[model samples]
Target: MNKEHKIATSMYRKIAIDIAQSVADGKYVEGQKLFGRSVLASQYKVSPETIRKAVYILKDMGILDTEKGSGVEVISVSKAREFVNRYHEIESIHSAQSDIAHWAQKQTQEIADVIQKIQFIVDTAERFKNSSPLTPFEITITKESTVIGKSADELRFWHNTGGTIIAIKRNNDLIVSPGPYATFREGDIFYVIGNDQTYAAIKKLLFE
Candidate 1:
C-alpha cells in the first residue's frame, strides 16, 4: 500500500520481534513480567494501541502470556527464538520481491526510451520524404569498396551515380551537407538523395 502505512505496520512487527529477541537472549527469563501496556508504550515512544498489537503478536506465538488484569509475562524462550527466526525468513522474501519489482520498473523505462527514439526517426523520415520527390537512401562504405579514400569530387559521384550526397555518418558523428570534398572511408554511412535507379547505380559504381 502507501509508504506511510507500510512503515507503521513494519514498526509494530519490528517491536514484536525485538521483544521476542530479548526473551530468547535471556534478558527476560520465562515467567518474568513485562511492563504494563502504557509503560511499554511510553518506553517505546509509541501509542498504547501499537504496544497492544506487538504484545498480541507475541502472545499469539506462545512467546508471552497475558491476562486482563496482570501484565504480560515471558512464557517460552524457545518459542520466542522460533518467532524471531520466522520473521527473518519472511523479511528476506519481502526483500527479494522488492528487488525484482525495482529491476522490472527500470527495464520498463529503458524500453519506453527506445520506443521514443524509434518514433522520432520515423517521423523525421516521413517529413524528409514529403519535402521532395526523391527519398533519401543510406549506403555504408566497406573496406573493399572502390570508393574508399576517394572524395566525391574525385569520383565524379553525382555524374556517375546520379545521387547527391546529403550527409555522412561516421561513428557517432553526423557530417551534414558533407559536399564534394568529403572523402569516403570504411564504416562511413552516406545519406544520398536521388531517383529510383540511383540506388542500383551507386552500388554498381562503388562495388563493381
Candidate 2:
C-alpha cells in the first residue's frame, strides 16, 4: 500500500521467483538448509533488511522454516508449490467469493465443495513439489525468432508436428493452457512438452 510495502512486495516477488527456480532446477530441495540472512544478502548484493523481507515473504508463502538461532531451512518443495496453488485459489476466491456466496444462499447450498477442490489442487501440488520429480524438457527458444503469441494456425501446426505447449512465461506471469489464441510477442519463453524429435523440429523452426 505504501512505498515501503510496495518495495517489500517487489523484493519478495523476486525472491519467490528465485526460490521457485532453484527448486525447479534442483538447486534446492526439501530438508536442505538455506544460507543465513547475512549470507544471502552478500550473495544477492542486497541489504540485510532486504534479505529479511525476502525471507519473510518465503516464510509466509510456506517455503522456508526460520528459527532465531538456527536460521532458515528448506521445508518442502511441495509446500512451496502448495503456496503457489493456494495463492491462485485466493485469487479465484477474491473474484467469486461474494457472488458464489450469494448464489449459494439463494440455492440453500454451500460453496465449500468448490472451495475444497481448490484446496485439493493446492495440496496435490505441494505434495508433488516435495517429491521433486524429474521434468522432461523438449526445446530451446532464444530471444530471437520473433517470439509472439501463436495464432491458431501456428498452434495447429505445432500440435500437428507433435509438440505440446505446456506453459509460457511473459515477464513474471505464467500463461497455462487454452492460450487465448494469443500471439507471441518478443521476450516470451515457452515451455514445450514433447519427444526429442518434436523438440528438435520446434527448435529448428524457431532458431534456424
Candidate 3:
C-alpha cells in the first residue's frame, strides 16, 4: 500500500526466489521437508512472517506443497525443474507488475517512471519467451564440492561439467559472467548454464 510495504514485499519476493533456486540446485530435494520458519528466517535475516510470505509465494508458483501431517515440502522434481528454468524472468515480471500496480494504487509516480516499469515488464516477458535451452540453475559451492577453493581453469569446471558459471552470488553482491580466474568459495552460489548432461555432471560433482 505504501513505499515501505512495497519494499517489504520485494524483499519477500527475493527470499522466495532464493529458496526456489536452492531447491533447483538440489540443496533441498523434492518431497523433502523444508527448514522451519524460524530457521529460514534466520538464514535470510528476515522475520518469520516474511519467511511465511515467501513460502506462500512458492506455493502460488506450484513449487511447494503442504499438508497437515506431512508438513511442508517441495513439489515434484519435474515441476521444480520447470520453475528453475524460468523463475528469474518470472520474478522480474512479477516485480515490475507489483511496482506498477503499487504506483497506480498510490498515484505516486510520474508518467516516465510508469513507462519505464512497463517497458521492464515487457522486456522480461520477451526474454523469457525467447530464452535458449541452456537456461542456468543455481548451485552452491560447499566445502566438499570439488570446485571449491579452485579456479575454474584449475578445476576445468566448464570443460568437465559442460556448463559455464555465468554469475556468482557471494554475500550481497552478484558478479555476472565471472571469468576462470574467479575462484570458487564455500557459500558462493554459482549460476550455471548447461544441458541435461551438464546438470548430471554437476549433480554428481556436488552431491554424490
Quote each prediction's TM-score: 0.56, 0.37, 0.41
Arrange candidates, best TM-score first. 1, 3, 2
Per-residue lDDT tens digits for candidate 3, residues 1-208, read 9998998898998888788878878888877998788898899888999998988888888889877666679886566667766876787899999999998866644555556644654454345447856655678877777656678888777788988776677885566668888888899987777776888887786656
Backbone collisions counted per model: 0, 8, 0
Model 2 TM-score is 0.37
Model 3: residue 11 alpha-carbon error in angstroms: 0.9
**Which pairs, if any, clash in model 3?**
none
Native-referenced Cα lDDT, model 3: 0.77
Best by TM-score: 1
- Kindly state the number of residue pairs that clash in model 2: 8
Model 1 over residues 63-140: C-alpha lDDT tens digits?
A: 999998988999999999998888889989999999999999998986776566546545655676898677678999
Write model 2 residue lDDT over 1-208, tens digit each, in one string.
8998887767766766577557645688888888888888888777888888777777876778898899888877876776666666886887798888788796553345445544654454455446744233533345576434456356464665565555555665555553537555667666554555666666656655
Candidate 2: 10-residue stretch with minimal lDDT: 132-141
Candidate 3 off by > 4 Å: 90-208
Candidate 1, superposed: residue stretches over 4 Å from native: 1-11, 68-70, 129-208
- Candidate 2 whole-model C-alpha lDDT, 0 to 1: 0.65
